[model samples]
Target: MATSTQSPLAQHWGYYLNGVEQAFNWPKTFILFYSSSTVQKSLFKSLFLNGVVFFGGLLILETFYNGPEHRILGCSYANITGFPMYIALLGINGKFFTPIAEKAFEKQAKAHPRTTPGSTNIVQSMASMIYTTIFYINCGIFAAVLRSLIPHAGPFLSFFMNCAIMAYYAFEYKWLYMGWTLEHRLTYLEEHWAYFLGFGTPITALTFFLTTLHSGAIFGILYPFYVIMATMATPKPATPYGQPLTSGKGTPTDLSAPNKVPIFFGVRKMNDLVISLAKMMGGVQVDSIVAEKQKMMKMD
Candidate 1:
């Protein structure tokens, strides 16, 4: 496939289409889900816990509080319910999701073993996970700010930004298993922005229009399936399509890939600021942990 004589434009579009294809690859998702006991157990736990229990509770509350007499109260609660539920789910579902992600990684590794597989002690793993969760929250806030601040184009910009974020979330487990540093993962995703944008479009589209609480519910139900898909997917980055630009004097000048986009720049800066503040308050220094992990990766 790499030796193909396709034009850069054609290859770029092919990568985009590949992402869209992977997103809808439900047959593969079902196959993996049913074939692995671990995957099944984890998914069932997610469905029952997040879906049936948490979302069900929300529905019950909404049903009772949705009448006109409680309209203002209901609307206000609806707006705020999703944020708390999101935090709660992160705490509750991390264990279940980790197993699912591990199962997916194991399946993929059997087919194609990684040369530099990641290994971290429990402490490092916990620190990294906490840092990732906080970064994700910051990204969410950044997207919200973008949507509110810009008038006509803000929502659209926010939508694409979210597509990139969702793509990262789906693929993060696989990358982590492969021992990618957080910076490396974010850099790669931003560089392959076009492919991820297409990959994440389906999920973002599904949840984008719903209320925050409802969106969170739907996302909880659907996220596990996407994780499987991401594990199975082979993302064709746009780096291979770097066509050099020629000067008027016929000298080749620019050789940069066209698809490199700094989609995470704003959110990353925000996350860094938060991390710095936390450290100033004598909190865990995630950067030091990350640097240690990177050093270990290099040594290995």
Candidate 2:
């Protein structure tokens, strides 16, 4: 008797199971990620500085101002609370967390040295930095232009744009930590598109909604805890894509020695898409196009 093939959903039950497993393991993983003994000194130093700035500023605002309600004059207490949160998290991450993460990564690599030395991680880190920078710049410009064009739809547009940005902020740290290049990252996103959207969308929406609360000062103080949980919940990286070409029958080729992968770093498909778009737009002669529009307006 012939056996029936399982449905796609059944075939992919492992992904769902793994996701559940990760969820159950989250608290343990979070503690492990933060509890590294080597990071104590830098972590404490950052925490001390963050506390001084955040609390000291709040004290000054409360003392000299007309009243607690108008502590910062025109600015709401929420703004004071929120901005300091941003500074503390941003400062700590930049000053200590990143270096500590790198040190941990390096220690792991040294302990179990790669059989093949690959510069893919280095190239990926650089590409991720460039890609993130360009992405944020373009997102800001696009949002500004689009908001101007559709002022009536400002709230909806702002929320939509912010959701996309927040989603990236949630997972980009995991991508960086896992040493996945933009290409690998995109491919994993493609393959697990549904999972990623499900994971990130709710967090984005929740974060956006939290800013609208009247007691945002209290909520703002609690916001970083949500961020910490989101970071912890990020899944492990997908397996790296192997070299396309093979040296022998069904044998995957390894090019780690020469580091040829750096030449094709980042999301090449995205680059191609951008180039194609540029080419199409560039075909229009701007001066002549402007002249034609002017002539048509004059004729009308």
Q: Which candidate gets the maximum lDDT versus the true structure? A: 1
Which residues of candidate 1, in runs, are more than 4 Å off?
1-10, 68-84, 114-116, 120-130, 242-257, 276-300
| Clash count of each predicted structure | 0, 0
Instruction: State in Å the error of residue 62, model 2.
Output: 9.3
Q: For each candidate in the order shown, give its overall lDDT on alpha carbons.
A: 0.76, 0.44
Candidate 1 lDDT by residue in tens digits, 1-300 = 223244455666777778888999999888888899998999999999778876887787677766666555456444456468777887787677778877777777787875235742222556566666667888899989989999999999999888998899899878777777677888788777778988999999998878777888888888888999998888886676544433344443333347777888898678668766766776456566455434432422
By summed lDDT, the worst window of 10 consecutive residues in model 2 runs over 256-265
| lDDT assessment of candidate 1 | 0.76
Candidate 2 residue 191 Cα shift, in angstroms, is 2.0
User: Clash pairs of candidate 2?
Assistant: none
Writing each residue's lDDT as its tens digit, candidate 2 over 217-241 gives 3223323333343345544323223
Root-mean-square deviation of candidate 1: 4.8
